[model samples]
Target: MTNPCDCDIRLIRIDEVIEITGLSRAAVYRMIQKGEFPRQVRLSVRSSAWVLQEVREWAFSRVSPTGLVD
Candidate 1:
């Protein structure tokens, strides 16, 4: 049997987020400041991360449907 703990969600770091969203450091921080992005959960005083699924959803929400471009 597999350990139940193995199902725990993984936390992604800022660098991974940047890679996933293809945004610069400044741009991501700007979105967060504007309340347009998912907030990061603090792991420690020196560390923070975002839920992988939440980030993915945020990105997906910004996608334009085909033929809907202005």
Candidate 2:
């Protein structure tokens, strides 16, 4: 058993990821290939999704203390 409040795990598809990160489809895959981004979870043979929290964290990590990209 797991506690719902213990984790707010969510799965988001590529389109949502693009919208959240403001990156193109190719850019997302490219970053994943280069190990610069979080990899997607294999939901099935033909479907995949990323952890929403992980993606959000990745976006947040890109910001500098000056509140801008450095």
Candidate 3:
């Protein structure tokens, strides 16, 4: 069984998110702008990344048996 704690839970870079979600950078940003996706946290003057837990939870919501998106 997959350990819940072992689920990706690190702030991931845009490229890594793209790799995981198979979405273009533009698309991801667009989703963020629309408040339809998890937003990234600023890590530096220009670097930013999203919480792996939040992203995984979001994805989980979409595929979960329940209709809830939380």
Candidate 4:
């Protein structure tokens, strides 16, 4: 298995993801349903989170060369 510290695989909850991506919770879920966003990792029966890097990359991917979301 990979070391969490070495890989920087931090998991972020919904609230932090919303703050980072500037997307509403509903939008996030909707995008996820359409396969436009990264899916969350199930931590337990009632908890899930997104990979911080994946979320960041997805947000970055939405940006165009003109520095706007496409």
Per-candidate RMSD, Å: 3.9, 1.8, 6.6, 2.0
lDDT of 3 by residue, 1-70 (tens): 6767776557899998887777899999999999999999999999999998787776776764676544
lDDT of 1 by residue, 1-70 (tens): 7758677577899999999999998998899999999889999999999989889988887777763423
Candidate lDDT values, in order: 0.87, 0.97, 0.84, 0.95
Backbone clashes counted, model 4: 0
Q: Model 2, which residues run further than 4 Å from truth? A: 1-5
User: Model 2, 66: alpha-carbon shift in Å?
Assistant: 1.2
lDDT tens per residue, model 4, 1-70:
8795786688999999999999999999999999999999999999999999999999889899899877
Q: Provide the lDDT at 52 for model 3.
A: 82
Model 3, TM vs. native: 0.72
Stretch of 10 with least lDDT, candidate 3: 61-70
TM-score of each: 0.79, 0.91, 0.72, 0.89
User: What's the ranking of the predictions by lDDT, best on top?
Assistant: 2, 4, 1, 3
Greater lDDT among 2 and 4 belongs to 2
> What is the TM-score of candidate 2?
0.91
Clashing pairs in 3: none
lDDT, candidate 2, 28-62, per-residue tens: 99999999999999999999999999999999999
